[model samples]
Target: MSSARTTPGASHHEDAVGTAADGSGLLTYASLVDGKNVPSDQWVYVVDSDALLQDAFSSLTLKRKLESGRLSPEELPGGSIVGRVARADRETVLQAVEAASRATVEWNAFPLDERLDRFGALLHRRLTEQADRTIEILLREGHPLALARWQVSGALECFSPESLAFYRSQMLHESRHGERRISVRRRPDGVVCLNPPQNAPLSSALLGVTSLMAGNSLVVRAPRSAPLGVMYVLHEIVAPVLEELGAPGGTLNVVCGDPAPMLSAWLDSPLVDDIMYFGSSEAGIRFQERCVAAGKKPILELAGNDTVVVWKDADLEYAAEALTESFYGSGQLCMIPNQVLVHPDVVDRLTALLAEKAADVRGGSVRQEDVLLTPVLRNEKFFACLEDALSSGAELVCGGHAIQDDGTRDTAGIFLEPTVVLVRGLEGARKVQAVRHETFFPLLPVIAAEPAPDAVLLDRFVDFVNSNPYGLRNSVWAGDPEVVEHFVTRITQGGLLKVNDSHIGFLPGLPTHGGTGLTGGVYGEANYPVLRTSHIQGVSISDGGIRPREAVFGAWQAMRGEDGTAAAGA
Candidate 1:
């Protein structure tokens, strides 16, 4: 499954296209519109970041693009020219929406059970079979093998039997009310438009398929920076499943191009009911307002400044390992831990363990199975946050330098070393930018509060966690059940809470994404794509043909027992 290759240090190319490991031509993808691979005059060339870092390409056009600030190697994943894709225009975007609107008529009418068996079951099976290819594409796009595996696994878990069953129950259920049938059901929200994030686009796009289980037709905008993996998922994996189920053409449409124009088109389209958007909180909140103004539902997957609390009695080794997860993909992902709140008593020991662990998290080529670091082209923000933390009385515990692919320090290095800083007092924690916001780099802030009684300390921690404006996932590491219970019941923020568990790991029955506050915008909550992309309605039916007046005044009628005469009991 690995597409590992060796290339010369310098090579010339007319365009961004390279041979595969077996010497076959690189894959080319087209925008999927109305169930067809639609081509365009324009193209977005995808370069493998790893290849760029290795100096595999020295084309004059590439150099000029870089010199002119048009291309950033940090944005790409692997070293060679991975693939190229067509760029969509306004007409293509409109066509996609129309196709989705037309398909929903047939799609939304299918029985939930049938939809699950055909789409859900079949998707899981196909992804499992093609898991290797999926991971390979992800790796080529810059995700480390381990992170890629986790993404693939998380996507598969969403379609697991247990997950499907839970969704089934939520979509519709019935109950008997003596002579009547009372029911509650979820209806598709018509055509849905999804804009997956540049980071981890493929897996995010795959997970978006859950909306279809709720009977909604979809139009996905593959991120222009990383579209191949997403294009493959939709055009290859999902399209085939929809076809096998005899789904209508346009049941699923995909396009790749600029976001602003496509988003404007979606906002203007009457056919688009819900837009599943992923981005920073500032941008997402603004977009949410726009979506509402346009009379469309905004399903946001925004920024996360997740916190990990380590109680004094926690397994320090295990907790340290979990905290290290923040460095995965250089902490570019939203769900990874952003800050650590450790008990004053255990703060020193935990920081020591973290420092030791951080030393082993090396930055290198993305093709290496063990490497997690990717290029950080815009590291100025990372350094700014670090400076803010240092100025706010925080001490750098380990790593505050840029590391090269060869594990050496250089100011011009493309990777930010896994850095940790310790802030002494919780009261002043947020004064540090790294503590207050999502740095999106491999910098972790460990804060310890002034010593206090267990109950008082627990209360303060809960208050601090709730005060966060962003709410994605919050986690606690504690051995005491009572302490865990206190944190769980008192903490009033975040979408998911983990106690003595992996902070960013996924489970079949749990939501892989979502949050409250800024993380999800005005209506944000733990997102289940199936539920988020649908609406609910209550229903009641009676074959007894009860009179409308009698039904409306049933309680009074029962008391009178008919003919204006009370029953024997009455």
Candidate 2:
């Protein structure tokens, strides 16, 4: 394992968990087949300070030398070189998949209670002990420190004892019938491949924790752009616990590299039973089809074009505060509020309030890094999106320009100023590209709804939101309980419904992802990790002589207190 050199700056230390790197500063930690971290001569590149300060997305191959072994690195555009990352090869990835496939049998047979207890303890320990390290990597990746901590800590909190207990309860079935018993069991999906989003690696990586708890072996493909946090959590936090618990070889395996080939390998491999994917709708939909063709289950957390409805009665102060998070992480998050649907009565006031809040957003600052918007690499695409919004009869409210350290207003600069735009009405807003699609920037497009003929303006608003093609999450801000309920019930599109609260934050045990239309694939399935990674089968054991039809009739009669003739008549 080799690279050019470790540039002077912050450094990452391999934890004692299970990470082992060659002396050349290249780190490798995913080929664990049966509780062992198999050493790899192939190196995954880690970007250094020189590469980051350069701001030039150099071909990662520049950092690779002939001595680095057989693996050749490729350069990708539109990402910061936090460091060049070295990753596992195709052979290693397959071995990891096969390992998980083999481990699934014993893992599924493991007692549910014991599995939950042991894994739950590991989650708590890792969160308590290594949280700071996780947060540090997130910050270095340019996430606001507070938000980074939220992502890191939230990942751990998702596996809390209460949540796991709730999931465990769902894993069992109990029924009784006149001297007979029936039980239904939840079985693991065998090998689950977790492909987390690149932007929020830590939280996305932790999404698979419940799958592991469900007794399904895991093969995680860490995002190439930011693999450290995922690797740290896996090797440092998860891998150690598996080893200590005597988990079977091949129970957990991880790999990091380019996604195209890795995805292909996973899709083609018959051993893989399920894929937990967080990615673009196009890729996810294609992958879903292939998974279906192969008889594999695909649990997708796809792109979100989230919409938020603001009723005339909404507390503007509270609504403004919650809605400003649309600009959080430069609006790069999948769950970030993408479009605002405000009643015509409150349009001007809400727009003004939102503009005021957006102006306070800090960008391109050293001391205020925690609040500053991370610089976007795809400046051209961002500008094109901005222009498209403006062309569709949208009026700029507060910010609509880029900010740079050199005062050049270069779009290439790391930060695009938090922007607010107002369109005259829903029709105009719908034509705007920013409103129609997911803008991965701090661009908020507010659309004022025209008054409905009936008194149910809120109902009309709810219908409009429900009509949204993308459905990761949709929120409504209204103080009236009836209005909130009406809106919530009518809107059947999004994976989650938020009322009078921030839309992006997730509750434990509940799904953080899932949706309809473009967001959740054809079936509109919810990507609940514990539920998605397992299947249920009914089990029945009976005393020797009872025939199948008689047993069924007896059970039905016992419950309803009717004889066979009465049951038949009913």
Candidate 3:
């Protein structure tokens, strides 16, 4: 391990720091294979998300380096650098797979209770203890503070007592019968490989830890662009817990590299039994086909075009607040509301409130506590979506421009304004691409259905929401029990359904992630990684006195009378 030094103004927990040749601080990380920090000859740097916004000199120097070919665009992600991560090669990926395959033997043998204690209970406690440091690393890696905190909170919720208990029940259950014992249990799927998405890699990686509770060894590919936080959680937090539990050295392997080779390696490797993939739905569906062809279970967490329906009876203020969640992380997150179906009666009021709230969501340096807008590296899609909606006869409610890091409007700005468009009628809304597809940007479309009887409108709203191609989450807001019930029981979409609550907030016993349809491929649903990475087996043990003939015919024989004849009813 390289020695770490604390730079001036840095927190004490910032131990990933190393001094550069000029004596300035640089955050450093390495890939972990077989419980070792494997450094590489090639390195890639991740710029602080706020570096360009906050430091003119650093920004100018980065620009000069880029122009001079001293720093290639591929080497510096997000435009400038605060940290350098080892870039793993094909060999490192193979090493990780080999280590994970070897460790799975012992890991799968450990009792489920012990695995949960180490991976669920103890890991949760350590994450809480290091919460601040974790959040700091997330911030440095470019996550807005609020989104980062929510990610950590959601990840921790997976290991809560309630969640762990639920997992335990799902994993195993035993029952007693006269002279017989019946056990239903889930067996580890052996080596499970995780390909976490780059947008929220650390939390996604942390969530992947639940596979450990199922006694499956892990090979996680940290996003090369944002590898530090993911590496910190795995090596700094998760590894220690595994060590204390006496897990094999190779139980958890992490590598940072180009995703194509790593994914191909996993798909082709015989030792890999399950692959937890996260990406766009189009690509994920194709990957799912590949995984199936390779005889590996594919657990996909894909794109979400989630919907939020607001009835006229809803508390407009609260519903509006929930709608504002669509703009969280500038709407880059998969779980946020992508489009809304509002009762025409309440559409105007709700949209007004949403625009008012969205205006408060400002773009600035990630270091700012109040900032939620991060740099939208490629906003061409955002513009294209916005234009498609408008051209399809949708009216712009508010926000259709780009904002600079300083929160000023400029075409060249890196941050997109929180945009909301009003699409009239269900049919017309479908014509808008932003409403039908995952915009993956701060572009929300509020569709106001044509006015009709309450029953007719309610049915339309439910049907519209259910017809959505992508389904990660769906939320409804209504004060009436009937309306809420109608939505709850009738809407057959999404992995989770929220009612009159924060759309993206985490709750115990509820899935922090996962979805149906495009959001999750054919095998996708509310994903509990522990359960996803394991398979169930039914076990029945009989007493020595029981004969095989008796076991097979006893139940049927009981229906017969004592005279060796069938009973009256039989």
Candidate 4:
């Protein structure tokens, strides 16, 4: 369903509205609001369910429909909806953002409890009722089922009081000099914008949650590729709560079209205080450069080349199980393992074990499942590296097939099979290192080594993975305690560290979301989402009378409440 946002009140434009689904067949193209199939007549913009909720339903037409509680059956779209978002020029975005900037005063006046309670309800419903649709829409929009579900569902956990209460920790007052001592407090940055990628479109667009919960207005840059999930997830979920919670209207806005104009506008304007970007390291750096030039703070989570190492004392079964994490989603996850380093003693044994269990390592279209992997449709560049490895004498122990020339959605279901290439010796090892680059397909390059020859081989391998420029998640399968301790201490590299388990084990609330190095600027962790988006306000409160007080205490005499342990001197 398409909802018109611009108006002197809502009016209709009838110009033989025709739309196509990303150049795909027309029959499959459906819009959610009106439930109308995109007319096979002319080309138009297509949005998935989530975007329907965010941009469409939340638009003037659908918002009135939902508010009036009279969604017409004739207007209900069939598959999904394709709507028109007039590709606005920079002035449009600036105007809308300035309008929101003016609205922040009233938006910030709402009590935190009431506001959170509203979003909290929406968050709960998101997890409980609409989660399945959220999953289906994400998968339909071209993301792995498990990965998509986790991306959408996991972020839902942020709705509860416990989830965002930490945001208010420093915002509240503490006791000190008989004046209800308020140490530090944080305020919204007025307006914050988010531009998210298409891979996890549903989850990424919600990066606006940072601004929303922090009392700042959020204007999201929704990816045009799969705008459905982002919109619908918001309308069917967040909108109702935001309304009931009494958030000022226009505080949460969405612009659904080419992000180029919108992003450029946001960067050039003084209205936007922060810009959160999620995508390639290259794009992020360039965007950040622009933001810096325009004097705006940009929070980015970019590309990662994670690694997984199997030790001599590792469990073959467990290491094999981790193949799901490294190879699944075609290794598109930022935290997914990019390289698998094997110790010499377990090299042959583990390869054989993997070959036997390789049936579990499968790939197909996003619509299909039990299908553990996806063909790396964009893997031609990586192939040159693979071919160079082969020419340099790397042996192909497993898969080598590439997707066919004319790959349709149906044909693209299965791309390259899970490949295992073993480099000749330590001489060719550099050719297969993830430390150098990343490959987003199910082609695993195994770097073989004989840990039996030296006691430090395992330690050295761990160090190599840790010392790499990328710092996502890296797993090591081993049963040795001393080795675990050594790694746990020395490996301060990846955001998530795994021992004797899969890289996706601590997922959902896991700290594997962000990394540093060429990967991005600031390291990221999911649990620290709120803090990452807001500026810190540290206030030191004492009973007062500094001039009368002769000396200052060197240590804090208090401890954090229910946050686990005490600060060093507390």
Candidate 5:
């Protein structure tokens, strides 16, 4: 038996376009639109399903046929599609949005404990039975097994009941202002449309849990290229829990389609009150503007160009180990140490250790646990940046070439040599292309900066890191307490700052997404999703909470629906 099923509007050519019972072939994953699985072949007419279908087809000849509208019965491809995915039509999208809007009202009305309990059950399932299933789907999607497990585990911890409670308290709380009693209430912003990036499959759901907890109905559009893992987690793991708890059909709607059209729907529809977008800086800015124009809120998680600083008194070995994470996931991660600023005194030894570590990175299939570096799509961009760095007074200390095979893997995946480039000095690094932009590759640029007096060096490093356009996270390795304190107090660039600790991986209680400049948006602030998607309204309940002169207080009370003729202070 095959895993894929024919839904409405489907035209199946053969059994090859699905996962086999033995788990030998591709899984033509389906979209969950309004709590129902809609297959890719069954996409409605409003969607350009044929175009999407062609993208997944294994044969180039078949792709051309489908593209030119010349695909005949005899010309239909026989082989399985490698990246089969479902694309939702306009009708389905609108239906999901409408259902979400309806569900939002009921969800908000549910008792707080009941809502929390439902989520509690979800967490329990995710950590137990769904744990292995989630990891398998993640592995099938090309994520390393260890990374897949870590992502699932971390996300589970983040959405735990205790974590949610802590986040809620931070977002909203009640207090007394002088003699007046005030209660702060956070209201849902209605339907939130989540558009997560393809790089990290779990980000959408990880963030979406916050909105759901805050009583907002969600319409999450899974990335078309990597929808299987997301769909598996949602449909297989979370959906069952939702059903068991008798959640409304629209309470958590998910769909997959061409991102351009889905983004258009989010911007055009008034039903979507908020759009949580994760992508490049340019596109995120444009989307932010569109959302603002449409009277909707946009929570933007843009690009990151995190940097690390190594002081003279630091442990060079530990620093090298931490810096090696920059090549993890082929440097596709947002928070990995992309650039490092080392003191000239320890620059030589540190660079040597770092180069040796980078060379040891194993390159293999992305699904493999030992393979820390995976194939990157933007080879031209990576090479161009590498060339620019070499030409601009930067010496290639370790790797400077692309390797088809690392003598370990037989897979046909593009592999870039784990590269480490040494810059002449901090001034020279400023001119290097790799230093100018966030190079999302397995390339790290090391700059040697001459340290000044203790106070002066601390200020210089802080300013230097702050000047970088991208700022998701930054870290420093130093033994001096005063130096660490100075770095922490003076640095106002990245959202997260680590002192002599591993820079990768996020904890459950800390702010997960935040930064300044490019890493964050125009109004860059620490992202607390539940708080960002909500507004705080102050309410005062008393017999006479407002007491003022007749000219102003009387009018205010009358406007507030209180009797104007009531006695003073009453």
Candidate 6:
């Protein structure tokens, strides 16, 4: 909880939130687990001569710190542990940053493959060496083991050979017409602000590292809710790799606490080129708007209310497994299926199987195989929202009960049984609802449609999922080759779509990240993680090159030129 600080700059009073920090300045919140050692988050504003000047200085200081490795250390509330970084004085950050700018140039020029290999090695080592401890921190931090596994394992896979394969697939190109050979490089912006969710720590670091390996500097502004967990993963596992790999010091900077101001600062600063964020769509959208206003590229893995379309041809048991994964993290992920599109023919059968499976899923304390991350249920807020939707006519099929089990009803012990709500057709109060928009909490609403082999239902479902305001992930549980094909063709066009598979099964190097349009600026699966980080520069040395189409006219545009050769465009 200690750091050197000089004269601080602009500051502003914090806005009121639910929880408050203790006298020791420790952050305290009503987390999924109460009485835990997790710190309460603190918010501060950079003070300046004027409000606009504060923003201007905040942006300036953010850039200097990002360029230099001299990050302001964040301390947890109570001063027992460090939670978020403190903002250093403007002069101090600027002076420290001056040294790091040189490293970015060198890091960027090194061959991409060589740098990727270095990170790939880091992933390998982190997996083998830090496996046990990594798992422990994630569990203690509130993520269920099942969810933690994805976070840790996803990092390993992100820089693995598979990811390399995906990058290869994306980076190469074949010429279509006349000597215009091309390749698309997923360039890294100078520095990226990756704000990961509390539910995922390792996955967030992997997101930043994958982009860094793609040749960009990075600054991770982790969520204040569980910043320490992510900080551990980054500082312990990823940062060591960057050091060993000869990457610039600021290749990836880590910070926790309120991200709004840092995000605003980064967006407004020239040193930071991109912002990678993960959270509710509303928050992500706000970040995107600010980034756009600042002319920064944003890669938002925003909210999702994904739907799994199950056809009568599908194996009910397999579809059930997929359903389990969709809600594995208590349906907090953007990829988790928020609803099910069950054909009427198999509704009764699949419904029965799902109910049985749901009943059997182990509950209570988070265990190794624990698939569910019991949400910090909103209680009265949850029920009130449910009632509003139900009274508006959405059917409550089963299990909306709060934990009536005396064994598990504490202030911080938030748990909700897997929910199953049924909505008829596409509209009514159920249609175009929040349930239809994004995955939040562990609620699954099934939209049952008339039985038919026609792919029309799935097509309509795809449109509904993709056309909605936000885009991240969508999936299908059908075995029909035709359905699978359609799902692959249509869904992959978005972020990471799966077929007869779990919605959250993301492999390294695969474009299993980033989304389109409403989600954020041009980024997805973080697929653009590497591609978007670097800018494109075309180079050609033709062994035998240059051939242009001679127009119908004898002289043509080329001959008309003074040099008897047309400009490339001409």
Give the best candidate by lDDT.
1
For candidate 1, the clash count comes to 9
Candidate number with the higher TM-score (1 or 4):
1
Which prediction has more favorable lDDT, 1 or 6? 1
Q: Please give the range of 10 consecutive residues that has the lowest summed lDDT in model 1.
A: 1-10
Q: Which of the predicted structures, 3 or 6, would earn the higher TM-score when compared with the native?
A: 3
TM-score of 5: 0.84
Q: Candidate 6, residue 84: CA error in Å? A: 8.5
Q: In candidate 5, which residue ranges exceed 4 Å CA deviation?
A: 2-28, 39-83, 116-121, 175-181, 405-413, 543-570
lDDT of 6 at 555: 52
- Give a tens-digit lDDT track for model 1, residues 8-56: 1112132322233334255556678777767676666666766666653
TM for every model, in the order presented, reads 0.92, 0.88, 0.93, 0.76, 0.84, 0.75
For model 5, which pairs clash? Answer: none
Order of candidate numbers by lDDT, starting with the best: 1, 3, 2, 5, 4, 6
lDDT of each: 0.84, 0.73, 0.83, 0.59, 0.71, 0.57
**CA lDDT, candidate 5, residue 317:** 97
Better of 2 and 6 by TM-score: 2
Model 4 earns a TM-score of 0.76
Candidate 1 ranges with C-alpha deviation above 4 Å: 1-24, 56-79, 559-570
Which of candidates 2 and 4 is the stronger one according to lDDT? 2
Model 4 spans with C-alpha error above 4 angstroms: 1-44, 47-91, 109-118, 157-182, 365-367, 375-379, 403-414, 424-428, 433-435, 450-455, 505-509, 522-527, 540-570
lDDT (Cα, tens digit) per residue for candidate 6, span 1-570: 221111111111132111123332322222111101122222322211122122334443543453244433232112222223333332322222332344567777878666776566666777668776676656645566776777767766766777666665664443443444555455545655577766664576666666666666666655655554555565556656666666666555555545566555566566666777776666777777777888878777766656677876888898887787655665666667677777777877887777767654444444447445454445555565566557656677655655522224344445556666666666452453546566476667777775555767777666666655555666677777887787677764356676776667766555556766555444544355777566665444444555434423435754567566675665
lDDT of 5 by residue, 339-449 (tens): 999887899999999988887886665455577766554478888899898888788888766665353432233667778998866665778878877788989999888
Task: Give one digit per residue, the lDDT tens place, for model 4 in 69-104.
Answer: 475323545534434322334544565577568667
What's the residue-level lDDT of 122 in candidate 3? 89
Q: Which 10 consecutive residues of model 6 have the lowest summed lDDT? A: 3-12
